[model samples]
Target: MDHEMTPRPDRLALREWHVDDAAAALSVYSHPEVVRWLIPDMDRVPGVAAMRLLLQQWIAESTRITANGGRWAVYRVADGRVVGGAVLLPLPPGDEDWEIGWQLHPGVWGQGHEEDCAFTLASLAFERGHSEVFAVVRPGNTSSAAVRRNGMHWVGETSKYFGIDLQVFRLRKADFDRTAPEGHQPPTYADI
Candidate 1:
């Protein structure tokens, strides 16, 4: 029952955030193309101070989430480079389900990296005892919708903090198990 068995170290890698990753992180966040679908106002050029603050928050959140068993930094196996990040944020006070979200650099888009990362995260979620995982895609984000459709079912719609409409997709453990390709394996800690 060790969750470790679910993530293989030989294929994809999932690691923790590092201060040295600040530049790469900022590059991804500050890219207009990358932030277009995200709800945050990362479209503008954030000042040095703002960037530092954001990195600091990501670092802190990474630590906290690791302790809670719900965060990951995705890296490519071909090269030991961080490609994206994802997390399973716990539900709020009255909510009963965890939310799964991910973001990859624009350079890696259309290469199936996002789908791989999503599948890895989803597998990790199920391994850690989650009954289901949900992804909220902003309306009109076809790429994200496609990623969601790769292994999840179209559930319905919901509203975000700013009242932006979001299309909700979900994947239960059974669904993921049945849909995952044969010979598929999740990433391991050493692979990071």
Candidate 2:
């Protein structure tokens, strides 16, 4: 197994994607509740084979992060189960700005897991020398908007993806340092 597949002690242990996780991932992605906010044209009920293909693609992209940068699967520390995913994708090559995105299973909704994972990912990005992290959310997604508001400043709208209106929010390294929980020190990529 690759070192990235190894769990980190400090984080909720963002792990590498695995083929075995397809069933669980399908459960999350196929659910109407979860898909409501995702890509509208997404398969409402993705099959296990399709999910496995998606997982394979994710694993491949993550492997390229050393050269291209990307996302990670958010696993729970308590059980090592895959709960969700997070990513820091560059808007344009060689640019310091990146879009940070996260999606948690509906099962963990209302329990603050998203916020915890977001904080961990943001800290990871800043420590990796990223100047800023931004999230684009739909206006009606109150829960996601709340998570964005917690540490990010509203940066207005942009019609870049999803073919729908989006509200952009950003968090600079400086603002993240001031707003993150007390004693929340940032973690270098080596720390992961």
Candidate 3:
């Protein structure tokens, strides 16, 4: 990931996360409805201090280009609201696994945002010289299953990543390109 980035399709943009996003992050992430099915601990909500510390971590991650990848804040083109966040980060060392994940506000749930954000970020990864994009979904999270439905194939169940057992899904650039309309490509950080 570039230190400065804004990557997306026409309707969505993935911007670098900023301190200003703290309230928005808390608003969405701390709410039970958003994290319940997505995170390992559905009951886990980062407190204000914890969230701020996390924001700092996100800032650091955004600057690095690694298998662990980085997180980008998702913005709606029509209104510029920070609706959610997406990440294309690395798995554990030597596995060379790149993971894609999303955390969206429940207010905007079921509107295809996760699919759009994940697809764009995965495309960004491919465009950036990465081999494959993966997503780890907890077994019962049919909400997160939408990304798998978008085009990712189920690899299997595993606890190898983050030490959390999850249903793994994957999408390769070859497959992404084949499924995309002709001439389709994910936008670059410079595109914004």
- Candidate 2 lDDT, 40-153, residue by residue in tens: 346654699998888888888777666335667777676767777677677543544577777778887776566666676677677677777877777787778545645788
lDDT of 1 at 92: 48
Misplaced by over 4 Å in model 1 are: 1-12, 40-49, 66-69, 91-95, 160-162, 188-192
lDDT by residue for model 1 (137-185), tens: 7778878854554579888886643366778788988877666644566
lDDT of each: 0.64, 0.67, 0.71
Which candidate ranks first by TM-score, i.e. highest?
3
The TM-score measured for candidate 3 stands at 0.82
Candidate 2's TM-score reads 0.81
lDDT of 1 at 65: 60
Compared with the true structure, what per-residue lDDT tens digits does model 3 show for residues 1-192?
A: 222222334355677788778877777778887777664465545687767777788888677655436787876776777777877777775648888788888887876566667667777778778878888888888788667655889899988876788888889888886544234454555442
Clash pairs (backbone) in predicted model 2: none
What C-alpha lDDT, on a 0 to 100 scale, does residue 94 get in candidate 2?
57
